[model samples]
Target chain A: SQTIHQWPATLVQPVGSPLSLECTVEGTSNPNLYWYRQAAGRGLQLLFYSVGIGQISSEVPQNLSASRPQDRQFILSSKKLLLSDSGFYLCAWSPRQGVTDTQYFGPGTRLTVL
Target chain B: AQSVAQPEDQVNVAEGNPLTVKCTYSVSGNPYLFWYVQYPNRGLQFLLKYITGDNLVKGSYGFEAEFNKSQTSFHLKKPSALVSDSALYFCAVRDGRGTNAGKSTFGDGTTLTVKP
Candidate 1:
């Protein structure tokens, strides 16, 4: 079975610091990867998605960015963290070949900017 | 483009009672709808989806959703609510079979509280 992994699990950063969150999927190749942020534990804000390596589509223009350096590895980054950038970051993956497959999500990372 | 609406922000139900969380959507093409559940501080879990076929689709943890094309709704339902079922629920929709099929628009989400 396929599984998605994300780390540092939790992080605390001072304002204006650089940010990097990593995600990877095992047991699947060429999967569609996505990044989302949830604030106040409600609505999900889509950050970015990638269909393949070196291909990333950003949904919202913000302080954050995403890159898929490998087929099953996606990374979310920020040059300088903003107070508003603090939230729970979730990474998800879906079958690339499926027309409408449901996304499988990782444990997620909690980021707090102080 | 596709959109999803979850009208209620919160729902309160007693344990063992029937529960329902409402959802509606819009899409340019055929709609592929999905339901997800999230516990506190956790990632959303895929509950179920509707691509084609049965209007009433059963999902994980004894939950189900009714797909009504006429109503443009896909409300999540469970026959008997459990205290453990208390969590957040989300509805999502996407265009089927064409461009942007992989991308889905999500609702604001609903908080379900199953009290004992």
Candidate 2:
């Protein structure tokens, strides 16, 4: 079975500080990875998605960026964090083939920018 | 562009009663619909999906969804509601065509509160 891991589970950072969140998937190769943010009332918003290594498509223009360093490793980073950047970040993975593939989500990281 | 709409922001249901969370979708080509449940302080869990064939799809925790192509709706339903079922539900849709066909558009989400 495939499993997605993310850390740190919870984070607290001061404004303008750098941010880095890591996501890694085990038991799967060449999977489609995605980054999503869930905010109060706003729901789940897609931030970025990567099809392969070094290939990323951003859905929203923001301070955050995503990178796929290895086939199973994805990282979300920001040079500087904003107050609005605080939210529950989720990492998901889906099969490369099959149109009906369903995404599997990680435990998620709750970030609070003070 | 693909989009999903969850009309109700929140739904209240008593335990043991039938529950329904509405969802509608719009997409360019054939739409692949999915339902996910999110508990407090947790990530979203895949509940069910409607690919093709049966209109009624059964999923985890005894939950089901009915897909109506003409209505463009995939409503999640459960015959008996439980207090543990209180959580946020989301509906997502993805186009069956194009290179980025795996990309999905999610709804704003609906909060389901099952009262004891």
Candidate 3:
């Protein structure tokens, strides 16, 4: 069975600080990875998605960026964080690039920028 | 562009009563719909999906969803609600055209509260 793992389950960062969140998937190769943010009282917002190593597509433009350093490793980073950057971050993995494929999510990281 | 809409902000039901959470979607091609549940301070868990074939899809925890193509709706249902079932439900849809590589759009989510 495949499992997705995201680290720093809860984070508290001061304003203008750097941010890094990692996600890794085990038991699957070449899986589609995605990063999503859920603001307070809002739905999930797709931040970035990676198809392969060094390939990333960002949905909404902001201070955030994503990188696929390895086939099963994805990282979300920011040089300087903003107060608006605080939200619940989720990492998900899907089998392949087909509509029939279902996505499995990780435990998620809750970030609070003060 | 693809999008999903969960009309109800919140739903309340007794433990023994049936529960329904409404969902509707808009996509250019045939829609692949899915239902997910999120518990307090937890990640979203996949419940079920409707790709094709049967309109009625059964999922985890004795929950089911009926896909109405004409209505463009897929409503999640449970025959008998359990207090443990109380959580946030989300509906998502992906276009079947394979244009976006299985990229999915999600709804605002509906909160289900089952009283004991």
DockQ value for model 3: 0.82
> B1-116 in candidate 1: lDDT tens per residue?
78899999999999999999999998989999999999998999999999999999999999999999999999999999999999999999988856777988889999999999
TM, every model: 0.98, 0.98, 0.98
Give the per-residue lDDT digits (tens) of candidate 1, residues A29-95. 9999999999978898889999999999999999899999899999999999999999999999999
DockQ winner: 3
Residue A78 of model 3, lDDT score = 99
Where in model 1 is the C-alpha error above 4 Å? none
Q: Model 2 chain A — which ten-residue stretch has the worst lDDT?
A: A37-46
Pairs of colliding residues, candidate 1: none
The sequence of per-residue lDDT tens digits that candidate 3 reaches over residues A58-83 is 99999999999999999999999999
- The local distance difference test score of each candidate is 0.94, 0.94, 0.93
Measured against the native two-chain assembly using Cα atoms, what DockQ does each of the candidate structures obtain, in the order listed?
Answer: 0.81, 0.78, 0.82
